[model samples]
Target: MNPNGRRGVELMCTGATSNSSWMKQLTSASRQGRHGRVLHLFFTSLRPGDRGAADTHPAAIPTALRACARLGDASSGRLIHGLVLTRFPSLASDAVAATALLDMYAKCGLVASARRVFDEMPRHDDLVAWNALLAGYARHGLPERALTLAIKMRGQGLRPDLVTWNAVVSGFALAGDDQMAGDLVRAMQDDGFQPDVVTWTSLVSGSVLNFHYDRARALFRRMVAAGNRVLPSSATIASILPAFANVTDVKRGKEVHAYAVVTGVEQNLTVSSALVDMYAKCGLVLKAHRLFDKMAERSSVTWNSMIFGLANYGHCQEAIGLFDRMLCDGARPDHLTFTAVLTACSYCGMVELGEGLYRAMKEEHGIEPRLEHYACMVHLLGRAGKVAEAYDFIRAMPLEPDCFVWGALLGACRSHGNVKLAELAASRLRTVEPANAANCLLFSDALASAGRQDDVVKMKRLAKRRRIKKLDGCSWLESP
Candidate 1:
């Protein structure tokens, strides 16, 4: 009734009675490229952990495998693989089924098993197996091995498919070999294999993951220019959003938002949340909030983004309110949520309230304090002029304190004229960051407040000896 041939089978299901007919739908849906629907139908067809005749059901296995790849949920894929090994070992030898098995195993990080499966098979040289193994190596950051396998596949008179080419390109990207990746893209084009959104997204992701922000932005521009040639996916939008966030490029961020809206790319939950975070981080929280409110669905990530954005822009009370609303909405707050709210409390000098939330985080929420949470607590207590208690808190910490924890106390010492504690904090700071001129200056200020001019002069001389230049001040202003 939906008119699309793809949905025809669902209509047929109303009168379908036979188990074989149901299994037929599995193969049918997969062939129609309804991967998510295939998975949904597959799981619903049987109860969890149920397997009998369907174990060797050739059609069922491959569909499940494809679903795993689509979901990027390796655990589900591996479970399917385990079902195969346990039920029908012989079906694992069929070329199409075996190749799917190999691909699933490789993608799920069982490369060694995939290789063993490939080696044991009579059709070991099948292009599918070759591509699967190559992709495994490429995905796991073995660029050299992946490239070598590409050559070997060629030597064996096997032409690489689009998948093989993408894996190799992605491998180079993962290795931070941008030049090699670019060359491969050109070669791929020359070979008559036009890159799809996955291919371009992989390249963009590789650049972003490796901190090549400029290259990422340039690649995004290239992606936009070729948008007519290959439509970008939600993933492509998500991958490029962080590049705009890192640079605070609000103009480009707006362009990306428009692109996502125009392309319907923001329909995906991850992309929508990423857009929210990008807007929030680019000094555009109002825009971020509008998008957040508009999202029909949200994960903890979206809520965390709103909370973090509010705290970052000095909306402490609002951030705390949002945290309460998040809990009431049945969204469990993670360590990051607590860290953001605790930081807000610290900023607002609500020491008792901050400590209560810290305890509630562990007792009520069952989320243990990570280092950043401890850092927030230290900053909170220290800023309240309870320097001795802060020091004791640091000592009682089960985990080792980092420079941030000590730096918080030292900053407090400077504010409160606690010269003795400042000396201890400064001494520790020197071990952590000997060249930090601001910390040194703060230490000197703490000493000067106690009439210790000689120590202040010594601090300045030590800074001069180290030749550490003072950090330049930076501020933002809105243009009219």
Candidate 2:
């Protein structure tokens, strides 16, 4: 069904009569990221009663398995496994073919199935198969299993290599076991394998994931200061940028940006996208926009960040315009895209447009409205002084409204002086998030705004009885 894959296979099959030629085409398509083409070629080449097609194409089996691994098409991988069992049973004894199957299952998160393939391999001495299964366990949050497997592998006299060490280290790092990950790094160094860019990037990424932004930045600095032995790759740049973005540390962000530009990774898609996001979160919308516009390629992340930046800064129309351009450029909008544009609509009081897009999101784009989408709608209608309409919208919701939905209604009721609806919204919000004193505070404010001093006093007494105290509000300010 993939048009490019189908077209590529059809055009190249003109002289692919021999089994080797068919394998060349399959592997070529996979390497080109045309995994769909590889599948198409694989299945189509298996003719009716053509046992030779399956039996002779031993090389094609591993290539197809690799494609299945990349695509995460486990069902197709199973089908190929079945074919190998029925038609090309000799492939079951081939180490390369069996290893490919093991890797495909592992990458698809089928650790058990990958283990079965690894165990059933004609030879257990294949280092590549061991690493594939080890990585599968480690990558899937079973670092302990990976370590045990590595010990067993070493018992079999197969020395652990750089890939094996990095796999275990990455597993611990990704699981947020920084102490264990560091110990593993030192251990690998003792084994005469110096930590490379993958090792450092894993540490940096793990720190970022755990919200240890300072530690992530420090590790990045250490990696950079390690001289020419290992410089920050694009992955390293992309990983550390989020730490800066989350903290709104534009100074460090710009320093990293300068590094990226000097290292010629400025044009890399992921690095550029992260830069756009970093600038946007730092409140430098103009700088974000400039970087966004200059990019030759923009992903949904790039577009969403720029749109969100514009919407957050009161440039609602510009945000909406950019969304239109995104559609015109044939970029598929995801849920975040609609969230960004709906936010713009709410900010600019474009209630009708928001409604249309909400419907289009479900009908045209097939993206079901999530809780955030419902919350945005309530905000759009409520802020437009249509408090009654917002209440009706909440009533008609397919799912039960959450705290954000009722909170939007309560906030709207307060702004528009709808005391009755405000009380209802606050009650529902309290039921949804009972511990949040902010809801009670807003409801009390609504009562005060409606000149109901007696009701406000009663609410205060209720709050005191319930032991609900409003938390102090704080804001993050840019450093001087």
Candidate 3:
């Protein structure tokens, strides 16, 4: 019988002693980015002398499955799992292979299939399989299920590992349950699992995901002070740098850069990009530019960071120049590159330049204009007092005009005191964002500027009736 599917493990395995060799071969294949070779090796290969039972060898399914997991090749993983079934004749009952299979399927976003495999397996008190299932649930946005499963796992006499604790913490963090996430960290400590750098890193990334920037920064500081055991890794530092940038805390961002240097993570591409982005956001475009120039290698992300940083600081000429350099350097501009350059054109009043780039985005790059790109264009036209042209552009939009598009138009109207256009923009904004009072206030101000006191009175009454509350305005400045 030729080797195929579930009945082929007898042909695949020769001896248990070959586990290390099998792993070394598969791991090498994975490192070389030979996912196809991995597939062929597992799914189509026949080992030496495996045709006879006298030459039978044990196969290492777990190691091969892990390589597949790392490469995100679930197709290869499933084939390996099928071979495990035939060789062991108890695939579902085997803890090691079952756990790996469960993890691979979960990471591939096939949770239903993962759960099916878990259910088919005979119940056991092992923690590895249980943790895999819990991680799958957590990673797939089923945090409640993971939490409940954690309780269930404990009831079955299984102890939670550091991964299990990390899953629960990360789940709560993603769910924006900061209190619960902190509680789990304490519980992990009480359970005798010292929080590693990964543990803190997860919390930091989660906080950023959930928009808790201040908390992310605090976690970064704690991670830095974690003694000799867990100094901030490049990832931990990279994660926290953006929080400081978001808050415009340039002083702290500088401190993070210094920390990265001492930790030897600053020289990494990811950390370097984050540093460039941080400096740019903090109004240090030149610093960001210098850092970009010094990098030995550049990815799309690095180019976008420098472009966005320059554009955001109103350095239209420099930003657009850098964009040209990026293309010359064989770096293809993404949607974000266009957005940044277009934003620079808007702030600098380079209308013709902006329009040409917009056309280039579609004709040259084949990238369609997204909402943000359109919004930037609208602001570009509106900021130049071309109220009528901006309004016509909004009318001709391929997609339904969203709040940001109309908001940009309304702001332009407010700037130029175009009462008629402002009223039109205000109507759309009110329909789309009824709860926002800024629209009403802007409309009233625009009407008053045009000496339409009665219209202003009516607008104020409308705002009062709707009970729309205005958001508080706040600004940040870096200290001297």
Per TM-score, the best of the predicted structures is: 2
Ranking by lDDT: 2, 1, 3
Candidate 2 residue pairs that clash: none
Model 3 agreement with the true structure over 1-480: per-residue lDDT tens digits: 221233233345545634545445655776686765655554433456443321233334555676677677877777776776675555455556676788888887678878887886665565777788888888878888898989888888787888899998888887888898899999899999988887888889889877898788778877767678788788878778888888778888898898888877887888998898889888898999888998987878888888888887778788889999998989888899998989989989999999999999999999999999989999999999998999999999999999899999999998898988998899999889888887788788888888999988888788888887777887866444
TM-score of candidate 2 to 2 decimals: 0.85
What C-alpha lDDT do the candidate models reach, one value each? 0.82, 0.90, 0.80
Off by over 4 Å in 3: 1-29, 32-105, 108-110, 120-129, 155-157, 359-368, 384-386, 469-480
Candidate 1 lDDT over residue span 1-480, tens digit each: 221222222333333333576677777877787777777776665575654436334457766887677656677777777766786565566666677777877887777877887786665457767988999989987878898999988888898889999999999998899999999999998988998888999999999999898888888888888758877788988988998887788887888889898888776899999998998898798899999999898889999999999888988898889999998999888888898899889888899999999999899989988889888998898889888998899899999877888899899899988888889999898888888888898898898899999989998998999897898998544232
Residue runs of model 1 more than 4 Å from their true location after superposition: 1-87, 91-122, 356-368, 473-480
Pairs of residues at least 3 apart in sequence or in different chains that clash in candidate 3:
14-56, 14-57, 15-57, 15-58, 16-58
In angstroms, the error of model 3 at 71 is 7.9
Backbone clash count for every predicted candidate, in the order shown: 0, 0, 5
| Model 1 poorest ten-residue lDDT run | 1-10
lDDT of 3 at 24: 57
